[model samples]
Target: MRQVGGIIFIIILMAVMFLMDWYVYQAVKTLLPDNNLVVGKIIYWTFAAGIGLWIGFTFFTIMREGHISTRSQLSLNLFLTLFVTQLTVIIFLFGEDIFRTLNAVYQYLTSTDTGKAASLPSRRKFVSQIAISIAAIPFTGFVYGIFKGKYDFRTIRKTVYFKDLPEAFDGFTITQISDIHAGSFTDYDAVKRGAGLAAAQGSDLFVFTGDLVNHKADEIDPMMDSFAQIKAPYGQFSILGNHDYGDYTSWPSREAKQKNFQSLKEKHKKLGYELLLDESRLIEKDGQTIRLLGVENWGVGFHAKGDLEKSLRDVGQNEFKILLSHDPSHWDEQVKKHPKNIHLTLSGHTHGMQFGIETPVIRWSPAQYRYPNWAGLAEEAGKFLYVNRGFGFHAFSGRVGIWPEITVIELRKA
Candidate 1:
């Protein structure tokens, strides 16, 4: 029964895709010279065929395996991204053909050769050229995003002043990164460079807000050395994110899933990070002490395993506290209102959708509509939340305007 349903779904999807491909073909035919039409046909058919193959493979996995692995899932994501982005650009080109078609119909009805009559001005030659010219901008941007932008890691530094901060920790610095998504990385040197940059900062402390791997624990094994490069005298601390639970991929049994998670925790250990699961640690400098709390993945609608209250049970009210919760929504739903008075919260799950615009004056991403605190820093009352854009890309395999981020936050006494 499932096989029958899957076949029917694939057929319907292929039909819709073919119709869309026809429109793209028609748009290109109108502008290209006769000699160029063969080339255009080749380009259109090749892309259309690739999409059809991926759709079939995706349906097959859903029926047989129940869930696709992170690598195959990302292939589907990249295919759709190229399909939709190019589809948008060509839709404008199709509009020009619509006007040309209307003009042709007008010309045939008027029969201007035998009558001294004015006909609707024929579509100008430059109109088709202009449409094609404009379509190139998005095409170029997508190419750059896939090849260059994803690896363009940048460090963002913010100095946060606190009037009530203890003087002993006033000049302390903390480094943070989130959403490693190690399974999605394809380039070794680029990945090493980013990790090397984070380690070079030599901050007083380092924290990794999670999503360490996309699905499997083994993904980080090959790159363990690069991540281990990160060093701080205070040591590194980490928490899990939505992807860490092996929820996105199929497992043989419940026991297998549990085992995978245990292995993932061990991977963090290999990377020199102290895996903090619903816990708090006290870091002392001179005679002053501050609390560092970490909780498991907690988001508005995701795996809400994080226990903020349990982690803070041992913490005192007077001590300055930094909480590492994987998702920013935790701040909106729990962290901010908690009576513990968490001074700082670090999170990263949105990844700014791995594409967006950020500048000194303006910051924006489609991810913001779903997560108000999608990127950078935001404060409410006296509490702070810093969303670390992300340390790695995931399904789409690239970043656009919002590149990978390594966040350095400095604490100062006001």
Candidate 2:
């Protein structure tokens, strides 16, 4: 049954990709001048060839890696096909006009329109394109280097005086890190850097909000020492994310997946973290109690398996609560309106995949639309949500505006 379902999903995904590719090709072709048949053909063929080569190369590389069998090759191939197709589509959609406009400006500058070239719309467009492209080349190279280097580590600290903090937990500081996808693109250096940054904050408590590994539990074996360095006075706690469940990749059996999860939880224990799965623990300070609730991956339409109600069952309603949830959507739909209001929710499933500028006034990530409170701090119904951008890079293996974060949150009283 699982095999059948997987096959059907692959079929649907491939159909969508083909349709998208066709749509983008037709759209771009329509925008070009009808007289420029050669130019249009060249553009279309070039894009097609680039996409084809990318797909072929990806498959060849995967086969060479020998991690997955040919029987499962279709699944991997589909991912590569879609990724490359989308990348090509975006390049043509955004790059074609810029290139054309630049060419026109260069022609005008070298032609008879020297005085008016500065004022002409075409000239302006050309100059803007040239400037942008020139700037983009180095920026793109830097981003590529970061991706290849797999060094997406950053620290964010905010000061909250002891007076501003809740009476129960004054001078309390929490280090939150999330989305350490420890697989092909991540290593001990990245983890060490993240831990070093977190440790430098001098946090009292450390919280890792899921996605410790990309696929399997064993994948984290290499980074155990680095992760162990992340220690705080209070304790370190963690929850499971969707990726941590090993859903994206195939396993031999359900039992295997369960075993992997159990092993991962055990690994977290070894790393000095109390792995919370629909459970809560209390931290007492100066005779006051604060509850820390941790739940498994639960999100709308994705994975809604986490049981928050069960997790918070033992805790008192008035106690200040901090929840570690993997998906920000959990806070939006469940945590905000719970019978006992969770004072703060920390999540990190969204790695801000499409990290870029929305406009001059707004700097945003694509995850923002999918998740109401996607990144940074947001408040709703008196409850606060801090969605960490993530501590490691994924799939595309890069970070843009939404860089990897080691969030040091200082709790304060209202």
Candidate 3:
């Protein structure tokens, strides 16, 4: 909203648009037939105009109000995503054209023939055609991700064996989800169905590894009833993620941000989750107890409010502990280093960046670059961490290769 920032943003967006338009024209103008070219031009210009209008709307709105709400957030996120993917396509096609140009330059300089003119090489129609075809694959997939992939909830069942697990709790089961980012969810029925599926797992304990909302507490207010359906005898436990503190959005004042944080904590309670804020709880059976500890938001470079020492303050060193810290980076950087043995840690702040390839043969996501233990389970000498990909989408509005996830982990004593 600031004038200088707005002007800079406008300049950058204009430059990007100009380059994109040029590349798009050069890449596909010649391939379409005359009839199709007419339609394509209409489509192209309409799309370009839409982007321009969206940019104006977003900038002006933010300039006037100094911030954006859900409506503007949604529009802006969509526009940026479209811009990035289109830019990628443009870069690829431009690289192809540059190669052709260099070859043409070489041909002109090297030729020795007389009279025959050395005409600059024309773009290969076939190559342009292939470029577009290849680009369309990802474009179509991204469109589908926005429409369908985000809501396609898939439950992942995993069994982990632990030699130090208590014999009494050997067969304990936990259903874990993370990064609800409730602000971005659209369909109630679809979300409810996901919650239903998690409940249907019938685990002894249900846990959410943080990120209950995007930037504010009210995001989850409407969906309390649906989430409350998930219950376990031991109860539902949750920890805070970086986003839960309302740090990503602009607020009227520090007091407002604090109030928003309080409301988010209350939302967790209302949803039947015993929100663990740098605290510990004991899950006891007959004469045995396993410590369930949780900390506030902690990440290597993010909002690191989670206090591992405080959370484990009075707990005994020998107790079999299950710690819930939002970011896996916390586990890698801090939890694993402590002398007190933490048998298991559950986290999910990465969300796999909402895109990646995951299979038995290969598990990969851009998130892995930032957080080594970005998804699934990572193990050290005797400690383990399970990073739930995420339960909901965030800024991008939808997921792609990394669809929304529900994880069911059954624990067994080795």
Candidate 4:
């Protein structure tokens, strides 16, 4: 009887998801009048059926096995089903466009003149099509998801030798880990592994650039021990990301959200991190002082409320400074052109959610085009920005070419 009720509940949930998909498809189709309605209908039916079967099978498998099943067969099936469906929909929607783009690429390659090549459509279309096809596959999304959920680790280790050193802190190593979205979906073991990885990187200082939890601070309370493991001789410091403010979900009032933010700040302190909210701290090394400044989420056209100037007001203009900001846009708009030079800015709001190929020269995330300095080390006008891909997964629950990043930056004197 219990099994029957459970199955019924699963069916209802599946029906809801299918209806949602159908509604979305209809809404989208209305925008493309020239689109093949037959193909759209076929795609919609395929998606609905695929989602239904996937959800149904998942529930059945769960019923057959105990709550803590080791096989993970059902999960795999569900993942594959979603992946295949996504692939099918992508192909259905963009198959002709991809073919056309490929033909254009072939023509460009076969052509002789530089002008002809210049006139040729940039490889963006073909590359985007291929990337979409790859991501559409269940194997790709599922495998990446498994690794991201399990490992809780990714790193960028680049040897950047600086010609000049700052008198205060030459050869300073900073370890930055960001976007640890601890919540209902993230496994405890993964969090533990992530903290372990962060601790293993021997650095003078540790910084968590933000997005501690997906929703509420309470969601992260159980995982405090995991986070506590991240420590350094100097200290572990943090700043708030947009999500840390709890704006996505409903809070009874503005006061409630403020309370939640305060709780998250306290939680960070409890985990042995100095929560820097529009504030600055000085690190003393070798009898010289370097300033560390952190700001609230301030992005152009998004949340441009963070006071970068105010945060750096107390710090000396000539002091070597590192800024912990959540949004990369902040670096582009404010820090890059600020009268007082900021040496290095670390951020990780762009989880590289759509992690895949952008072009021959670039592995792209949707975040890249939106922000000037989207990922990796981007330098403009003598300022350096390193955008960590992120420490954890969100929304789609996967990582592809843009894997979860753990950045170990060796700050050199110039």
lDDT per residue as tens, model 4, 110-189: 87866775233433334444444564574555565555533546767744444434665666788898888776344677
Candidates in order have lDDT scores of 0.84, 0.72, 0.84, 0.72
Which portions of model 4 miss their true places by more than 4 Å?
Answer: 1-47, 50-138, 146-152, 159-164, 358-362
**Distance from true position, residue 61, model 2, in Å?**
9.9
Model with the higher TM-score, candidate 1 or 3: 3
Model 2 Cα lDDT, one tens digit per residue, 187-304: 4665677678777887889999998887788878888888888888889999989888887676789999899988988989999999999999988888877899999999987788
Question: Per-residue error at 196 for model 1, in Å?
Answer: 0.8
Worst 10 residues of 3 by lDDT: 62-71
Off by over 4 Å in 2: 1-51, 56-142, 145-150, 159-168, 358-360
TM-scores for every predicted model = 0.85, 0.73, 0.89, 0.70
lDDT of 1 by residue, 1-414 (tens): 877888888788777777767755555566777898899888879978887778667767766765545556566555555565557646775676577677766777777576555344444446545655665665566568778888999999999988888899998999999999988887888999999999988899999999999889999877899999999998899999999999988888999999999999999998999999999999989988889999999998899999888998868988899999999999999999988799999999999988777787977788988998998889999899999999988767777788899999999998
Deviation in angstroms for 354 in model 3?
A: 1.2
Clashes of each: 0, 3, 0, 4
What is the TM-score of candidate 4?
0.70
Give lDDT tens digits, candidate 3, residues 200-235.
Answer: 989999999999988889999778888999999989
- What C-alpha lDDT does candidate 2 achieve relative to the native structure? 0.72
Model 1 Cα displacement at 113 (Å)?
18
lDDT of 4: 0.72
